[model samples]
Target: MNSSALVKHISECFIKPQYEVEEANKPVYLAPMDLVMLSVHYIQKGLLFTKPPSNSDDQISFSTPEFLESLKESLSHTLVYFYPLAGQLATQVDEARQESLVFVDCNKGPGARLVHATIDMTVSDILTPRHVPAVVQSFFDHDRAVNHDGHHMSLLTIQVTELLDGVFIGCSMNHALGDGTSYWNFWNVWSEIHMAKNRTDLVIPSSHLPIHNRWFPDGHDAPILLPFTRHDQFVSRYEAPPLAERIFHFSPESMSRLKSKANKDHQKIYTDSKRMISSFQALSALCWRSIIRAIRLPDDQVTNCRLAANNRHRLDPPLPENYFGNCINAITTTTTVSELHEHSLGWAASMLHQSVANHTNKALQDFLKRWLKSPFVYQIHQLFDSNSVMMGSSPRFDMYGNEFGLGKPVAVRSGYAHKFTGKVTSYQGYEGGGSVDLEICLPPHAMEALESDEEFMGAVSLPLTGY
Candidate 1:
């Protein structure tokens, strides 16, 4: 095996939809809410599968020629349901108003991208380390490009990397195209299609079809115009400081205990079962407190933890659970370090719970309406500060169920897309059943400080190893 080169690219090809896209669906209007994320990095995510048995008389492994063909063909069929993925971003610049508009041009014959690559390392080489190695990022090539760059590049890119002993299927999805739920939905359908092997008679059922209609505020229309004419005005690009990314595994018991402690002290506050503290809120609060303590932010200064809230269910008459595209709203909670020191764990967790619970349907509408009036793209620095924690991703996503001929995934990992100092992502642990893998990025000193904190480290399990 060549150690000098970690990842070797084998081939690259564009996969178009299996059938012709309807002319009516050729263009997808960019909603005001979707444009806010146009400049953010594409979501870099992938999974690791167990070692494949050598070529045998009967078994067809994931890397087998027959299986690879099925996988590619399955993707083509999956694209018909998710037609916007097989397109490029289009910009409408208005010189008169100094505003630029972004939308999806889905008619381009060249659809989504698929890359075939190989790595010299084994599964052990990746999962053995306490902190995941940086080479894991090599499985993806478009991490550095923002979603706005999708105008020329494919809106969705998939890279399949064959390891010395295992395989990794990495996906780089444009943030504007979909959120985590939509992303996993596409993969799940693709895997379903691949289960038939070479069969072409299967088709996505109408019930499973994704709703592409962009959500809009009342009295507002699509193609939400941006205030700036150029990408440079809003897209944030700067040299980030050195950082360490680590994943902390938490068992169901630990998560439950955290939730219990948080809810114990908040009974008098909530008094309602519907407003009970959740494992997510408790765990997130724990991370936020530990990071602030590790970084030693001034007690007098204010701090914040911004959470990604899915609004599909929060709307009046609630959008369909399968509603595709970005319907994510953020909940930012501010507090002082001294207040955190004086409060119990439950108190901090309650702040998070309340922040989310308080975001009513009217609030969701108001937030979007305000953004529609004064549109601005999300900037990197806003969430990149070491003093704050920006938590995205969710433990509810079926990360372990993405099967494509191979067995269940051994672990789930993300690439270097949104790896800022305080960025955090939570994945459903491979063991399943309420287990969670908490991935966080921080400076080296702060990471070390966190690992040493007895109160925080006590609830976390050891690093992941191939089972």
Candidate 2:
């Protein structure tokens, strides 16, 4: 279909819930981490795949109606294990304590919203590697999917869009409910249920059941889980104008070269034990340097790199494998543009490595303690600056493993509506075999500069034809 026709088809599409899916269990109080995420918007993800063929002559084909029924059934079954997803976020005031708190009202009513939509476009039409696909934005229900009012919002919304020769399953979940790990755990289990055809005998193994209990140091008093009042507001004073989104693929070989270059100069200065740097650290350093170069910032200006570090494993007496909640904290490192430009790639990489390494068990515990005392002092503005960049998510999240009976997704993208300037999200490349794809959003001029920079372009592989 042509672009205009695709737009027409998308406009003609309609969405409605297949059925009500309520929680199969009781209500649960919001954890401290959950309260911290209450004001954040939903995280959106899309999975695209070709339509599947029928398996049996008598069995119904995977048509729109049949597929919708199957997906709804599987989702309802999956919610049995993940009950909070079907619940709603409600605030309750403690009269005796004169404090207000938020919790998930698992009343087993007004379940998650699952909408069905169809468009006259193919997956190929929306796979442009350099640009954010328009269809990707059309596949989601952004306004209704997010709880901007902080009340009466469904915990999750799933939109299944039908394409000419493919399908797009878009999911939007409240960030206050859980983090990416919890989000993917729900997705993978839902896929498992769908693959099993919602059989009653099959169940998500106990090992994968989500643990809801919040973990704290022994004898430590738990703080009140209330909304942030003053400092936690998202300040937009430093917000830049709208940005352009682009995708760049890095092959394993290019990544290897970057790693080698990042460690070459540092090897002589440090002992063997401390000489090595991780792939993520090296690539982040490269990205930081490239971004600064592309933007042509003043040499004396200070630039920062903020990384979202997962604290699940970093905590002392690590949380359970299935602990499902926000366990990530941001670690920021800063250097003058002059220092960064004058130093070798190894220097930048070493700084990043040490910044992350400094977040030990004690450090993480100390952060939690501090949070308990003042949860509202943080503002989104503090996490970002006009001259700085932030990187979230990981390339190792198994994004391509979500197969809902049809097949593995041909491509997966983080939803576009939620993207912000200077934000970067990393994903395992669909080409597989450990390649990395960086989805970058920046101003138009900066994007153009990065695309034209010879050093930056050298590490980015040529776009694949089939997407």
Candidate 3:
């Protein structure tokens, strides 16, 4: 759609009545996962042939304020639809507590290149697969880009691109918007409803998980469950240029071999939940170590890496699927740069596994619940350690199957990272079954090191069994 039409469409969307919460007086609580908004950042780009578009008049374009208001309208709908969820989470997040508002900024300088719209990133990098071909190329170049920080406030931005045609659309959703699965479901449904002009029949189906928070007295006060503050320590303002993305495909056969080689009894394990994180853990450790070594940082410099974990399953009562916001935390494991240089894949994988296992215990969960309710949260934000690299698996994004009846996503990608949080990586199920695709953003040197590492290359050859 052209910028003008998109603006009108947005204004019309906002004309609809806002939804009211059943209980307006309840305290707005923040979910553990909501903290991502504070750390989330965005970078987008558009690619074109040398000739560019001959149809100059038909190219995507947007005036700054028009684009911002357009985003404001869409977000308003999102806020109203998920009001209760936001209201509850708001009690915890600073931005959400202020009201369900989305923030917008205009990017007019070279520094603005840090974050790009989702559509621009995907289209410019990954090839659009036929199965998920609904590439909304026009949207990214024309619509406003929104970034949500930890405070749960959306920072909306608009970039005037030189693109003569096509489109780019992207948004950095707070982790609180549910996992990639939940977000896509909500997005698909929202788009359907919006496009249909009020057709409720197109709404997405929900499995309906339980919707209340549980305070497990039994799970509190565990020594290993220490709270680390991410707020003050991790600032989420500046944008960085899009780090080059390297996609690696894994085959099932290689994965089986790796698992067999690592297993004690020579038994084969073939489950997605158990092995996904473990495999990635091994790979990530290897990757992290290799990068550190290549950089030639002092051996004494610690290289701590973390895996983000969703506490929904670990909780006594699982959070509702539609909670619509961040609801997870991380499992941090530290290693001396020297230690990783000498360890084998099995050893690193074990470290990663144990770190996660340690957190899954009752003590961690209990401590987390109590910690959230206590005043310690203020103190924790003061401790942002610089030695860590954070990576998470987003294998839950079923891009190809997220068919909106217009074909599936031609390409799927998670957004960018802020300056403070360190490196971030997200893995997704590729077009081929058993094949996986990975998106990574790290310091430029780290990317170069991975490209030259032989061991990392071996791991990349591993098989993709299934999602």
Candidate 4:
């Protein structure tokens, strides 16, 4: 790759204060409560790949100074980079402190540092999967878990490693920075600008999904709030809920049968042109049951499951396709462990359909609107205190085909590492057409039980989509 062709610039930015403060007085950027949890698997495999880049040529490099300057300029224009600090006690201190962003110059340090490695390339590529696996492995080997308290932010570990065909780039981000989609949008925009490419064709404008400035439970109408100190107090009790994932490739015969059954269930005519009763929902029910049985939950125990719904279309101001950042919220529903385990596949799918519909209904939307306006939100901290599970699926995995033209991703999985409670499961399109890959992370014991369940495996005819 030509040095001149390297579109994105690299800047090793570190957050060092111009004036030092006492350790106790320093402003904490990452609050203890806001850090999203990651499963043990995610912590173990902290570094992993996203959708593969277009270039298979892996000789790693860094972005130029010009690129870094441009990215900094771009970031300065965006509100997503800034977060609101709650409480009047911290307000004055936060205002006086420097903005969280900083740039570290790695080229200097003089004298003895002459033989040091200097990576060159654009910052956008820094978010790519190339070098992440090794960086994660290094963190694992050294036993450096993310700091539970202090300045919370994402970290990129770009290194020259022989394991990743010599040059690989990896990054670990604070879940608070943004959801996966938002981060990807940021990277794609950075890449286009760095390469001096025409972004008009590739970049989606901001008008689509406007960033929300209000606190999550904004105003007097806000629906839920049980404010507390300490992150563990807020999230620790939520139990690991049940979830399942897979891609079902329907044959013509199977499709006909499904359509016929769906029509009979609805007592209405159906057309093949439009999909009916999302197949994803059907599959999820199956997977959830397997998970439930494996866990051996009590028959009457109510298990809550939710599908994270994007508000791109639902919001009064519809979020644009490329409006990047977290623009979605989840619609939660509950069912008994026994109910799920004993139900037929279709029954499971029906419940999922109704649950999602109920939550997304106009009444629900009205409730949320009123809730967001309220002074206090319902304090349902108990929801987080119990063992819970959340399963999510989106057709957005089609974005994995974003190869810059290299090829679609062979596999795509969400990165998670919540030490305490909650488990997440996701499915992404696989490299092979007509197939999708799945990844799940949970407690060590939970993972072990599922892996060993013969009955569960036999029922779904589980396919091995290796991690």
Candidate 5:
């Protein structure tokens, strides 16, 4: 779909945290999990909502100016609790120590960015297409390249795009700031504050309050320094190969069918009745199998799938669900193409389930110890491979529920950052229930093969993604 030619950029400004940070702007050191993501791209996602009906209560009857002001105001309040995001990433070079450390500098008063834009198009124009419109990228603020770029830019950007009969709130958060769990947690709190009548006096429940303390090993110091004098010395973003991305929506019934089939076939080998296949495992297995078949790799060729697991619960003393930071590790499961494509979906799921189960508390502790010994940074080459598939994001996030005084989102979309071949991100289906949506990125020929694969298409719900 072609976007309207009249795309106008209105205004851009920074929205600081409502309250001043304590200790005269002390630095908050990032943990190993956050530091490893320094080379990745910022996460870009947005929500689409239609124009609210004119109800007598006038809940959403404000004009464009009023709407933008309220969002900016509420965001300031949100940033007060999520104070780290309101700060900038800083590099402290220590010539004596022969190292440099990256930390969040809340001093000097940097703030989240608020960008206002206007585009002459309806919400339907963005949501109706099978492949999302390229114009959606314009809804975001930065033509951002990498998280390392956060050292000199706004760590968080909120661009509100005014539509013909609707509005879109697009966001771009530095990957180093947090993972999807932390990202969605901030969004949920912001929406909650926005929905309140007395926004200032509203008390955030303990359940929703975020804990900002960064995690570390027992003997480690506050900020772990890397053996590099400059940021560019160890961190750089490379050009990723061109890829095609598409979202596939599966209904509750279809999801249940896949889960049941996976469990049913798994019973053939193991009698472990208590350990049935999970919805995540089942769906991931299906995606892995379908992609391997579609790619048409040789029988002996090895293919790997990396599943990201949240470490909050796995920690010895579990962190609070609202603990705001990156606490995730990718669990890689490898298999030959023939082993994956020829076997029942259940077998592949079992492999993934065991991989996740094996990543217990001990494994995470050892990983922390190893990371402290050698603070290695990730690059594009180390992150992706031709024969590997990596998965991020989760279906459990409260994305559809982030109303922000408007109605619930009509759809959830992502920007062009972090796109690599065989990367899949999952979200709860727009209709709720047990439905799921997998946003998949792949090579052009592989995507064509997937679209035509009968086994994968047979389970997809009717009318696919759009409402």
Candidate 6:
């Protein structure tokens, strides 16, 4: 099909629901940390799966009406435990205190939205490796999936699009309501519920239930008083030209080689008790160095690598395994362009390792305390700066294991388009092995340079014909 025709086909394809489906429970209030995320966009996650074989005895059939019904029912039941997802964000101003507070209003009626769409395409059309497919873009209803000004914010929106030989389930949730860990926990529990659907003997264990109590240091209000600003204002200060997005797959062997190379390079400089370099650190360092080289930054220019680190285990008293909410902080390391381009991969990796190691429990507590005083001091917008790169998400989240009884996902992605130039998201390869898939967005010229960079190419596996 031609480009316009393909657009028309996707636009004409789906059936909208007649009414909204909400939680089958009551209302709840927002926690302190939840309010901190009120201005960001929704977190979009998509799972693509091929149809189950005809002879299969799985309770949920792929793309069938029975399947959709079971999904909605399971989601409803899942919300009973995760009630905040079914609620809406409500804001109230305290005139006496001269401040505004946002909370989840559970009684606001219509629950989370579930959009059912059908596309006249197959799974392979969009699962192409090394490229972000347009078909994948059509899987989610971007208009309704993201929150906007003046609209009543629904905490969760799910879109299930049926393909000719597969299905795409796209879920968009308000970031203010939860972090990556909480987000995956909700989906895992939903899948568990769907899998346990007609089996009375099967029970979802307590381990899966999300812990809603938001952890906070003593002496903090529900809406912590922090100097804040709108997301647009925050990003406008450092915005750069729009960037192109691409996916790069690194095999387990390649990652091992990269780690080994990085460690060896570190050994050449000074062998103080061998500093352990993790796969993530090695890969991140390599990407950071490659980006600087690709962009051809001036030798004297200063550059920074910012990584999103989960503080669940770094808090004073580590949080619960299932603690539900934003419990992450950005750890950043700044170095000159000369050092990144002139040094070996190990030098960059050591910098990342040290930056990450600085995140102790006291540091996290201090970060929270500082944020309470200066709420608008987040560094995410700095990613758009020409001299900075921000790495977000982890490949270890088990995204491929989100099986809703329709078999495992053939691929998964963060459905929303990343606008920042230096934004990079990493995920485990679809097979659940040690391989990593990097979703990177850079300016057009930078992308071209990265594509041709010899060092970067050495670690990336070329895309197969079918994939």
Write candidate 2's Cα lDDT for 313-379 as tens digits. 8887787657777787778889999998898778888998999889899887787677676654233
TM-score of every prediction relative to native: 0.94, 0.88, 0.61, 0.55, 0.95, 0.87
Residue range with the least summed lDDT across 10 consecutive positions in model 4: 107-116
Model 5 is weakest, by summed lDDT over 10 consecutive residues, at 458-467
Q: Is candidate 1 or candidate 4 better by lDDT?
A: 1
Candidate topping lDDT? 5
lDDT of 6 by residue, 1-467 (tens): 22221322222221222233354233334444555555445678788888886765656444467887777777877776777777676556555665555556654537777777776777766665346764566666443232322137466777888877888898887776788888888888888878884633447777778887667677874545433233343322223355667888888788889989988888887687467889889999989998888888899999989887888888767887688888876689999999788888998999999888888988877766776766652333533476778788888786877788878787776665344767788887764457888888888899999999999988997442212
Candidate 2 at 388: error in angstroms? 1.4
Model 1, position 129, has a per-residue lDDT of: 72
lDDT value for candidate 6?
A: 0.70
lDDT of 4: 0.37
lDDT of 4 by residue, 289-310 (tens): 6566656778999886666676
For each candidate in the order shown, give its overall lDDT on alpha carbons: 0.82, 0.71, 0.43, 0.37, 0.83, 0.70
Q: Write model 1 residue lDDT over 1-467, tens digit each, in one string.
A: 24455788898889888997684365798776688887788888898887667679877554545655766788898887888999888888999999887889897548889898888888877777778788888988686888888888888888988887788899998889888888888887777787765547776666567889988777887767888888888887645577888889998888889999889878765666456889989999999889888888888978888898888889886888677888886799999988986787888999998899888899988888778767778887674566788889888887777778678888888888888777889999767778889898888999999999987998997654445
Clashes of each: 0, 0, 55, 59, 0, 1
Model 5 agreement with the true structure over 1-467: per-residue lDDT tens digits:
34554557899899888878673267888888989888888888888888777767756564888888889889999988888888788888899888988888875346788988988888878777666676777788656468878787888999888888788898999888788888999999999988889987899998888888888867886888887887787687666576777789899899999999888878886776568789888888888888878778899999998887888999988888888889997899999998887789889988998899889999999988888888877786777776778787888888999987778888888877776788888888888887888888888899899999888888777643333
Q: Candidate 5: deviation at residue 216, Å?
A: 0.7
> Which of 2 and 5 is the better model by lDDT?
5
Candidate scoring better on lDDT of 2 and 6: 2
- In order of lDDT, best first, we have 5, 1, 2, 6, 3, 4
Off by over 4 Å in 3: 1-27, 31-81, 84-167, 175-185, 188-198, 202-204, 208-245, 251-258, 264-277, 369-387, 419-422, 461-467
The better candidate by lDDT, 1 or 2, is 1
In angstroms, the error of model 1 at 323 is 1.2
Relative to the true structure, candidate 5 has a C-alpha RMSD (angstroms) of: 2.1
